[model samples]
Target: MTASPALRPSAFTDAELIGSGRRVAEIEAQALQSLARRVDGSFAAACRLILASHGRVVCTGMGKSGHVARKIAATLASTGTPAFYVHPGEAGHGDLGMITDKDVVLALSYSGESDEVLMLLPVFKRQGNAIVAVTGRAQSTLAREADVHLDVSVEVEACPLDLAPTSSTTASLAMGDALAVALLEARGFTADDFARSHPAGSLGRRLLLHITDVMHAGEDVPQVSEEATVSEALVEMSRKRLGMTAVVDAQGRLSGLFTDGDLRRMLDDTVLDLRNTRIGTLMTRNPKTIDARQLATEAARLMETHKISGLIVVDEERRPVGALNIHDLLRARVV
Candidate 1:
């Protein structure tokens, strides 16, 4: 007989479902709080072992622990500690050759008895490599065999049946972050160091992109001689579409800036004649400028602070070399 499409007998109510989620979060939070207190001398020893190693940290684990191991490896590498993940299940199938004697092994196993991980311990021992184990069972075989063991044991699981690895995995991840952060502090890692590794992200663009990289150079920069009439400056600004034009002297040195705002104020004077007035007469003198080598994000800040939408790139001698507007920064995703 076919079954009816009615609700299951034990389905949860809306309030009960939300309460279960809340319980899980509270349990995981408490687990992390406990894990923090357990980060003792062994944690320091783990950092020491990794810092002393000349080779990369080879992190390994099975199942869910493997996921956390991979993330930890990435964090360490991004924070100036060279590291990578080597899955234990694949290690037995010839991936073990990827690890060298100089490298340190950071293994994660909540039970501390993952057969795939434990199986590789003898090989690491034979190579004389240091092993850092993060496990819940302090007296488990893998923990006992490791050079240093970090305890991430939690008294309870967030799962209703207490069989899933909810709290245990959370504790393990927290321990991994603790290790990465400690190593980061010890190595004196900087944002530039981090940006070099994360060059594809928004943070990298903010740190690595400079004014020269985004500014329009050469003939592309809208500018006119200071002696040029306002009508001529308008032609240059219209041709470049930068909403502004620079006023430079005969030597090509920036004398002042004339933008759409200045044009508006000039037009407010009913007697003023655009055809007869020189751009220098209506220009904003010594307008805000930036060095080409300065960060693009700095330009965003300068424009925001001055309530302007554009800036002129200048050399050491105050010559207008290039120009940029909020549109350029927007196109580059710096804004």
Candidate 2:
């Protein structure tokens, strides 16, 4: 329990500073490894208890453990588990009414003797709710009273004085993440399912945004008939401002695509006439296209894979139903 040496600005060295950081990381990594090995049948029991519960998980803790509990609750909620954090202090002050008989209480206390957390256990027991406790002490009150106990003990703290809850807190959080991932897998949660809960996040834009959501549709899509000239296709491209024009046949099915890059390359032929030359003769046929129902992220992938900057959203019959470019994806924040 010796105190850490005081770090004065003048006494600091780059190697010593970096070494301290590395030591902390090393200690926390070792603690997490220990935690992984100890996740046994009790872990399964805890997951089962949570899964069987009809209501949300009520996570309660005190101080630092409370912060971890809040994060755990958020992770669980976003990963398809119904859960929320309830401060033990607040629960003692009437917040306990939020918990129902169908809910499961996940209590966190590193020492397994937090008075605030312990105080609520009797109430939960009387309410006929299951208790899942996370603690560092195996023989403590919180552990003894619980239906399931997850041991998150670490040999020493990263703090030189061995007093701060550094390694122990890291272990607790890692354990919480482990539980969340296990529950997520058990429920067969998918990325799309996660995106539903995080619609405002970047992942949501990538997964939940369909090509139709961001594509230019109806007359907004740049298009011209195959019988049209290269000059006429350029008019459609300019008027629609899509940097490309889909050259479709009389049936409104895509025949080819003409882009700004085609216009640049067409300049290589000095004798080519934009007024008389047919757009179909200069257009790129069998170009990369996407389905309107596909994820917008898939469109970005298609563009990046082909080193192209635009895509045409086509229907099953290869008809141009919509049009979009990298800029459109950028606007939608899908790129």
lDDT by residue (tens digit), candidate 2, 49-79: 9999899899989999999999999999999
Candidate 2 yields a Cα-based lDDT of 0.92
RMSD of each: 2.9, 2.7
Clash list (residue pairs), candidate 1: none
What are the models' TM-scores?
0.88, 0.94
Q: In model 2, how large is the Cα lDDT of residue 62?
A: 92
lDDT of 1 by residue, 63-145 (tens): 99999999989888888889999999999999989999999999999999999999999999999889999999999998999
User: Per-model C-alpha lDDT, please?
Assistant: 0.92, 0.92
Off by over 4 Å in 1: 1-13, 201-204, 249-255, 265-271
